[model samples]
Target: MKRSTSNQEVKKLNRNRVFRYVNSREETSMPEISAALSISGPTVLKIVNELKEEKLIREVGEFESTGGRKAKAIAAVRDVKYAIGLDITKNHVGIVYTDLSGKALKHERVRKPFKYTQTYLHEVAAIVRRFVEESRIPKKRILGMGISVPAIIDVQRDYITNSHALGIYDVPCEELTACMPYPCELLNDANAAAITESNRSRTCSNLVYLFLSNTVGGAIIFGNETGIVRTAQEKDRGSVYMYKGNNWRSGEFGHMVIHPEGKRCYCGKIGCLDAYCSALRLADQTDGDLERFFREMEAGNQDLKKIWNEYLKDLAIAVDNLRMCFDCEIVLGGYVGSSMEPYIQEFRNLVAEKDIFENSGDYVYVCQYQQEASALGAAIFQIEKFIDTI
Candidate 1:
């Protein structure tokens, strides 16, 4: 009887593994799951049945069979587990409501006035509460909340380390979100964007993603994955800096001193990458006439073309440097990447001209989602955390 119990325990563990693997993706049949996991039919069915009873997996539809009965499709009850992704920028707060599958059901934004205080946090939290209430998703289905902030975050401290633009320093994230109905998590904006980008681009294992909006930042994927976790008050040290090279620190990319004599950055430095690669910089180049510059570029104006070409070259150089250091795919994102459809090839060509690597041809790609990339990625990260805990 003791030997029989050991076998039963082993069988139970195998079934749980199969259930997890299948529930990780979109709906699939038992045979497809068995083939994917290399498990026997009986074991898969036994495990799936147990999962179904637990209300973790459910029947979706039916699939055609080779020469037997129709196979039933199964999928994770993703709608039953929702997540919220908030992009807390210097000038605005962008919030998105999504289910476990990272589907954005709703989105909203609040403007940032030049003069504001920590009260802004409260205002942002209110916006989140309103969105969640409007979403009408059961609170029990919500896994948790993931917040993307445009600042260096001390994840262990649960506080913003430095955000000069917002005049915030070492403010506890949990304290700000104390009224939140669920658990809360914080990620650097750029890393959050990169996490979202990496999830959608499963084709590459290693990649660098740039977030170049009101501020500039980067996210690195060593093995095409983001390991977002939540621990105790000491999680602030949870950064990739100690893992990557010296130059690969998270928000420090924006301060790379591209132009020693150029305009001053929010961090009180001059001619940094953020000073050159941001939408604000582009707007500044056009004297706050963004529409005019975009029109001129679309109209093929020679002067604007020269400026754009220079911008692309600078961007290409940064990407090339990152590519050499990381030896992975490079992605362009942020407000610039959203409008990159017309110039992605232009940037690629420039990078190809100067890349030191032999496989430069396959190392660069554009981000799939432009506007909501970070929000979706936050949702994905939260769901993965939820799954791991379960």
Candidate 2:
């Protein structure tokens, strides 16, 4: 059965939609918001006044005349609140900060290996405090912080279920955030990175992001995040919702078996995609330095070239499988993906050979944001949630 909303609910929804429109654009007019959102002119006027009183938006100058008195130009006060994002990997921590514009204002990476202990958690919290202090952003202006971890995060339960790379399972969410100064939330690193990828376009899109890091990871993005509330089944909040499965373990693309009875995977499975396509497989050849591996390959190192050729063959299999299942854009992201531009065409040719529905591999793409994407995406989650409240 479908549920109906109250009059107050409808009004709030309309107000939120109106504010989102203003925030999304550089500047918009009252008449433009009315027509664009299908709200009455008086209703837009009232909402504009309400937002102005709340100081979430400001009326700046006016638009050119259209055979009538000029309309006030309204824009969102993007700096009213800010958010910080933390990306937790096996051996490094990536941090990024963003405002309403949803772009990373600044980011930094620190080398910090994972350690399961209360003391480590406290140190991580201190790291955030130091970063914020260095940035000189007022504490009051910060809304909250989002932590992107390499694990299956139960957003509703607020706990981490499993993280192969981190060597932990079923950890309480508080262990990592209990010592933080500001409110913090957890997100799967790949899912968080996908949000950053989608935000790159500044438009809603349905796509799948294939994260090629130490351990392979993936995430799915539904088309509409800020769209009107049409269904009661919406799970993850704000502009980008993840398709977490029944066990909250969707997009586990790494476990897919590409070559049965072949090489063993770290998860004790044979021939899982992770065993074949993880960036580590190639980086391991160059003493764990992925950049050096690429540089050596570009300089025509025959041994590295042989390894890359085999790696791309395996990557093509995974890329083709993702395309077949999602039928949307497949983005290669993470450590190795940052360096894939030089060989994407060659890899695409391999994917095209396996694809039955399409002969072109144009759908396969390299990710936009690199190491900072997960952290930035995690911060955007808080930013979008703040926008929803307005």
Candidate 3:
């Protein structure tokens, strides 16, 4: 027997559709929304009125009249609700407060090592409390909080399965959530970054995001306007080129055998991509400062230039392999990727040389964000949840 949809459920769906449509546009009139969504004019009016009453939307101004009456234009209340995102990495805690539209209102970063202790959790909670209070956003208006970590997370159990970067394993989620005053969720940092990028590129349905931070991670998003979401498994977050019936370990994008018995990786693997392409590799060339490394390279430092050239070569190989597999826009994100914007053409040239096909440049893009994407993405998760319930 087929399950029938209830009138209330249908109304809710229509409401969400109208809300999403309004949120996507700069401002829209009732007739425009109704025409765009194929909804009745009276239904659009009723929904818009309810949204205004709930403060989720507001009349901004009026649109030019086609002939007689000017239509009132409405927009989503960007700050109607707030969400907090925390990026807890091995070396720093990044915080971002986002509004309903997923715009970051404020951002803060603290250079504190991550520890799985109650003291650390309390410290993080305290910072969050101070941030919210300082912003003057009501607690009730804050939908929830989201934490992004560079590790495999068990969402159902709220457990950190493993975090080699932080050297932590099996940490209970309660350690952090227990201290938080608002509802909280744990998300993989790379996945969070992907979510943020997806929100920014609403028109792009298929995207492959590579997060090359302290550790390499990635997320593959596939779908259309009806819905688009990341579908990569926890274990396959960043691993590339997994053949059928193969038992390849994850995070091997960093550990891909780029060299034969070359530099040793922290993963106890020789010739890993991380040894050649990670930000740490560039830092190592310039005494742990990537800025200095790039500056010296630009200033005609022969040694640094050689190292960078070699790094780009390895990166090109990985990128080319990914392109061949997914054949979609590959977004390079994270601290290193954002900094590479100035040299995008150079990187594109390198990729073109390595790619078997022409026009590889068309498929590569630098992320819009650099440091705060993970945190922002985490906060966006809360907004997504709120929208789903509505």
Candidate 4:
């Protein structure tokens, strides 16, 4: 037989349950929590009072009266604590501070490239620390730090398997996060991107996220509650799945050999989709001048327009393939996806023309959060985990 729980254990469990119940609802009353947990009215009152005293919850308003006394409404004070999410990229590092709701209060980006030195880690850590200190939140209330990086991460092992852009090999991400006051967690950028997309588009039941930036990444969303993205699940936390299969590399869709002997890729491959469809490729098409290309596109330059059309065709094809494979919403993200907003309809129309699906025009579209997605996604990941523990 299972050992009987002590009063203290029961109280702790009930307290956590009450807190979670309140936080999950849009608005709730003390009596509602009491009824749901089958606890005494006085006991629920005591639990809620403690949470309010801790500044973790607050009275939002009053509920409609039922021909008697009106009930006071309560909701989670997400700002009582904050989470820091860092998106470390090769060319830049995006740092953001957000509440439990994934609302970014303040954010700043450092343009410096990744340096494999103590200086780099220190610089990133110091910026994050300063942001936290300025938020005026107590250290104890702060949730753990979440980091998103475009690398092969083994979160269980607390180390990065490989980061091509940063030239990192088996670096312990936890070690760097430990320098901060709160606990640290590492996540893959693609997985984080998928989380952002899922949160931004509530209507999508399942998703296949494609983040095509300087490097390519992907995420798979199974439903609202589950982030089926390979790197986000706890069981695969410390495991690294190297891309060993032919015709199927993890998010290295950018490096696919579209042409037998085309432009060389950074990975020493030829005719890479990245070589043909990336922002860098677009810039190269304009003779290494991004400003000129953008300006020309804006000015309705026929040549640039033609090039963009061809590039977007390749992107649409990629999306079509992902949709066929996952049978879910296809969300495009990253800096390039942000700029493609005005052309979303055109892209959709082109996909309709492809007619891959029997319905023809029933293809999914791009993400809503756009550029800030990965950072916000990293923050949401922490928030969801924290709620689960509660």
Best of the candidates, TM-score = 2
Q: Each candidate's TM vs. the true structure?
A: 0.84, 0.93, 0.88, 0.77
Q: Per-residue lDDT of 1-390 in model 3, one digit per residue for the tens?
A: 997768997788788888877887788899998898778999999999999999888999998888999999999987778899999988789999988677788899998988878898889899899988888888888889999988777666667877788788788877668888788998788888888888877664577777877777777776342233433221222212212112212333676677877899877889877777778878877777888988888999998888888877888888888888777788898777878888789899888877677755767889987769999999998997787665
Best by lDDT: 2
Q: What lDDT score belongs to each candidate, Candidate 1 first?
A: 0.70, 0.87, 0.79, 0.71
Which pairs of residues collide in model 4? 156-238
Model 1 C-alpha lDDT per residue in residues 1-390, reported as the tens digit of each score? 353336765565466556556665788888887897677899788888887887788998898777889999899876767888887666677778776565567777778642344476666667777888887878788788887767677665566777665667677776556765568887777787787776565443556787777677787665523333444211221222223334324535777776788778777778778777777767666776555777778888888778777777777767777777777667778877777777777677788888765734456777777776776667667876765443
**lDDT of model number 3:** 0.79
Residues 1-390, candidate 4, lDDT per residue (tens digit)? Answer: 897758986787777778766765778998898887788999998988998898888999999999889999999887666777888887677877776666677777778688777788888888777877776656676687788887767655667877776788778886556665567777778777777767555443666667767666676656633434542222212211222233223555666566657777777888777766666667776775665777888898988888888888877777766766777667777767767667788888777776655645455566677665677678777876776555
- In angstroms, the error of model 1 at 213 is 1.4
Show where candidate 2 strays beyond 4 Å: 1-3, 225-238
Going through the candidates in the order shown, the clash numbers are 7, 0, 0, 1
Q: Rank candidates, lDDT, best first.
A: 2, 3, 4, 1
